[model samples]
Target chain A: MDRAIAIDVSHLSKSYGSHVAVADISFQVYAGEIFGLLGPNGAGKSTTLRTLITLLTPSSGTATVLGLDTVRDADKVRHVIGYVPQERAIDRFLTGREHLELLAALYHLPKDEAAKRIGELLKLVELESHADRPAKTYSGGMKRKLDIACGLLPDPKILFLDEPTLGLDVQSRLRIWDYVRMLKARGMTVVMTTNYLDEADQLCDRLAIIDGGRIKTLGSPVELKVGLGGDIVSVTLKESAKIPALESALKGQPAIRAVRATDKGLDIRVESPEKALPAVLEAANRLNCGVEFIQYNRPRLDDVFIAHTGRRIEETTPSKME
Target chain B: MKEYWQEISALTMRWVRRLSREKFSMLFTLVQPMLFWLIFFGNLFQRAADTQVTQAPNYISFLAAGVVVMTVLNNGLAGGVDLLFDKENGFLERLMSTPIHRTSVILSRFIFVMAITSLQVLVILGVAFLFGVRPATGLLGIAAILLIGMMFGVGLTAISMAMAFSVKSHGDFFSVLGFLSLPMIFLSSALVPLAAMPGWMSFLAKFNPMTWAIDAVRPLILSGWSEALPHVGMVIVVMVIFDALCLYGGAKAFRRAMG
Candidate 1:
């Protein structure tokens, strides 16, 4: 229970009889930071979130939010944490203003206070003009904005967003990210889960790369990219079968730290991928392998997923049960 | 408790706003019971020269109380289904993560159904008054109707939510709810007098909480508060027990769903 840690999950696990939804995952989200749980669907992200929000009791281990046990002090935890679920929470039958007003009431805001908060949230989400329209008439993005507005109705200490931008258009997704950043700027701790690597890289101050119900790695975007130990040289091959030839040809190079074949191409880990590229290209040309594409960039979270799990992120299908 | 009341009032108003927003849906909920009371009861009473022996005096009066009870039950039970759909659609989980009390969730739903059904009940009562069925209980009867209806509505809402929580899909929820509503309605002396039923049916009706409710309302509707006090006591006790059971069951279901 460190003062700076808003959410402290210690080996938290949740199982249903035989199926383990989240298995012994541990992480800490510091106060006033945007912490992302990056994982595929059913990869224990939602279960971890549910546990933190006190929606489910952990099968083993413990989690505390704002110095309160997520289980024992659930009511208190609930009071401080605002959860924006993956699905839209807007009651289509309710108008936008009415929706916000109802949520404001749920937070025990007095009539005048609730009205003020509703007005503020509606304006913040830019739905004030459509405040009186039924939510059913709202576009997907507007509904999403309203949903996020509802989450912020209580001005919580910490916010848990479960796939906040899962199905939204790019504009809506960025808009949500903007609000999440604003929340951070206002000293609110934010915990979000997403499978999108770009989102995690762009929005998260610190991120946990989760897969198969466990923490694969945890670091800031730059820290993780740096921790990958070197640059990433991705060479897209014209033929899938040419990967072995390319790997063998580059294996003896001292600059090539690691080599692996991906569906898209062969990835070479080196101290400096740009400096190593000429050698790699020479090897590929000597091996009679055609290179369709090549690039040198800092390691991606997906590369980290691959580096640790020995599997690509895109191919890692989430289990059906979770 | 202050927080609870605040949340409840807020949720209650939310439903009121929704009702206003979705006037067509409100009209549907409002018209079905009225139609049941007006057309079917009106037609039955029109041919009631011989049927007066079964209906006391006016047939519409007998049917009005029954329709009110039925409307409350249907709306409350189905409100749970809507809750389940909201869960499936992810609204409930989102709401729960807010600082709102868990009880407020149930209260809001109960308030919604009660508001909808109360409006419908008033419509039927108004039409009943027009049909020459005025009770001497006057304001007392209206209070009793609102009280009993609200209790029963909340109780049924709890049961429906419990079923919705226990079941995985709306279809299953509806199936179980439909199965329960019919027996509960039939066992109660809603449509027929308990004395006229067969021996076993009469015995079942005597134990049915619905029977107690209808009996309680019958006195208020027919001759004000002249009835014995035991029936009122029985109705209150049954309502208490049913509401407690439903609330307990519903809370358990909610816990499981959240998990």
Candidate 2:
């Protein structure tokens, strides 16, 4: 897809004294695409997002939003971008509509125009009936919806969501996901950070897998999964001792690329699961090890992370995405 | 520039709306100083608040200016509290991410707290009327009293906002507030004349900005403009310097915190 660059972050690093929250990293987000920073907690997702939105200055390197430098033209950048923080940012004392009105006023929206926008945003978030109720009374999902509505008051060109569905119930999560897709459909570039593997895979157009304050890899979900290594046939042997023997026997067979013995069983990587399944079972039988269980599917994003980091990021976080 | 004012007014009105919703807090804020300090405590010491000692027609008249200044001090010192709560709850981050003028946040708070303090001053002056006391200088005298209170408030509010930016937690902010407010009120001429105090306490009162504010406002209520003029001039100069220093400190802390 040919799209103009909405955000360009080059060699960015943010540190606080001895602790580095975001090490040197660089990536670009194309306009109208949903770009995600996918990582477990404390992986510098928030710091990078903060810098891009001009909330925090980078320690080194530079970033531009719509070709405006983030630090030097922070004010100009703010006018064009919307940010929904990781934490719930609603004022409990203010009603949902009041929150939108306050933001509109901050943005200097004209009274007549602001009124119309507030009404439309309230409806957009499905808070029309509860718009006048104080946010303290809102449920977790409702509060979050109002928060999103407030962010959209400026009708920004790009929206940054730091963990958009974090702590949301399943139904709320789906609703937020739909809202994000709607934003993209309207040609608004969406940038988000998430620790949920499923969220990155399902929601993002492209994702940068971050770990230890650095981007381990960056690509589309499909490209990342395919690049990890194609179809995998997992063979579990009843006798754990014979797993390594079975692994060596399966290596270099037809369609078999590599074999690794895991605690539970043996995972055989292949060009295709259909072709590799026969070789895997045949090898297990020749080793005289009972093939207790076998399963195969297309490689997942987690395997891509495992390929790069030598560890599972899913183990460090929680989610259906995990 | 127009957007700056819009931002400030909207945020200030937010404070007003929040106060309106909290019925209990609204009532207490308006009536607390009047009931506990002005009416009860002022009368409890009526006999001892002599004309010679207080330099006023009566005890209530003397305490009126004192209470007005005291209210300004309390309101201004606690001015940063809402911002601190906003910071704790992550609203400050959301606000900073927007294009609104950053100074609007601090200035709106000063405006709201000073406005509330002026309202409290008016209420105290009206209550003093019930105690058979009137400002010897009249309506202009009431205006001067508010002016001095505001000048004093600008400085105190700046310091509080600075503290809010620097502190690690809300608990810590309140702790510092208590540590600073009580001693300042007692050490100044809020409850009694500095001359009526011990030698050491009176010496510290000489240095308290609250003492300068109260002394200036006292003449407005007790005597005429000629007598009040000098004190007002001294306090204004003091407030200018105090506000400058506090604003500088607040700006520095804000830059560090925001960065």
Candidate 3:
């Protein structure tokens, strides 16, 4: 689709000494779209965000925000973008109102404009009552909301959020998700990095799954999931040692589309779980492997990550279950 | 240019607000040195200090200059503590992400430290007055004293900021702060006249920037401009060179750290 590009990155790579944090990666974020860079820990998402925001100088290639080169025109770029770092950046001594006030002044908002905007942000984050209290007293979720408010202070055309909801309760996470949707509705371009599969599935118009500083796949969540193309039958053997036997047993079957080995089980994609389940169990029984766990679901982002990387993006199964 | 100063002042006000909110910290920052050092050390050395060498009527008067300079030295060297904490806690990174000039962060700290140093100097002098010590050149001399402290302070504060950005952690910063402050204070003629120091230390004091400051400030408090002017000129020259090195090195370290 033809759309104005908010961010354009080409051949971007960043290194700390000899260690490459972000390898040659490139993508364009269209204006007014919620874009996501989905990756595991240390997957260079933060580095890429920092580079686009001009906190870092890329080791190679170039990035532009609204056509302004990130390095050559960083000052201009700073004017048009707001950043919410992964770290808790609020000054504990400053009240929430004071934090917004300072951010306003840094952004060079005029006196009247800043006051009005600060009031609006305080209200927006629902920190109005606690705005006068020092941030040290605010709960973790409240702090994260304040952080989002700070990023929104400049009313930036593009917002770069590094793990916006890294750690929070379900309610807080939902509030943040709603806030993100509101920003998108307001016609703001948001580029966020997260490892949460569901967050990407629910929030992003498009995503680039990155691993080991490389982009593994890039597509809309539905498009990528559909690209994987079937329902998956997850079978966990009582003994994980029998995984290879199950893998070979399930392979070359009539209805089994693909057999991908996981740390604890085998993910077998099939045209129908009904057709595949009986075949999977019969093979497992023949191989003397007890079926400790079995699950069936339509294709998931987890499957997409596994499909590309030959490994899981998240640490465990409960991450998806929860 | 206007926006730059506006941002700088706003950031400076942020530091000021933090200082003012903690009433206890504010009270101690203003009054602690007077109670701990000016009253005790000044009175203790009264009889032992020689009027001929000190060139002041009593030890308290001579000690006033030391206290003023000492306050500046301490405040200047420790100016970067808040900045270091900001760096550690990620506020500095957050601030850096904004459009404001990066130097504003460091410059604002300098402004805050020097401003506090001025108030602390006046408080010490007011208490010193109760002890029967008065400046020979009066109000103008007081202004001159403040200027000397700031000039001397600019260099020290810049060096402190450099340390903040250069070091790996706050623990490292504080250790270096202790390592530098004790030797610099003891080696300078802050507590005693140059005549009282051992030959080697006296020779070393000749090179200490703190010496140039104390030598300059002492005359302003104990003597008049004629004697104070030459020392002031020497300190101005010394501090210009000192601050130049510090600020240059500080800018470099800041860029490296932030990058």
TM-score of chain A as modeled in candidate 1: 0.84
Q: Rank by TM-score, descending?
A: 2, 3, 1
**Quality of model 2 by C-alpha lDDT:** 0.88
DockQ-derived CAPRI band for the predicted complex in model 3: medium
lDDT of 3 at A9: 96
- Taken over the whole model, the C-alpha lDDT of each candidate is 0.80, 0.88, 0.88
Report the error of model 3 at residue A250, Å: 5.9
Winning candidate number (TM-score): 2
Off by over 4 Å in 3: A223-229, A234-254, A260-267, A274-294, A297-322, B29-31, B50-55
Return the TM-score for each candidate structure. 0.85, 0.94, 0.89
Model 1 Cα lDDT, one tens digit per residue, B46-104? 56534444455766667667777777777877877667877777777877876677778
> Stretches of candidate 1 above 4 Å error?
A1-3, A109-120, A222-252, A259-268, A278-299, A307-322, B45-55, B115-119, B136-138, B186-188, B198-207, B223-230
Fnat for model 1 comes to: 0.88
Q: What is the TM-score of chain B in candidate 2?
A: 0.96
Candidate 1, A236-274: lDDT as tens digits: 999888898888888869888889889967888888866
Predicted complexes: DockQ each:
0.65, 0.82, 0.77
Clashing pairs in 1: none
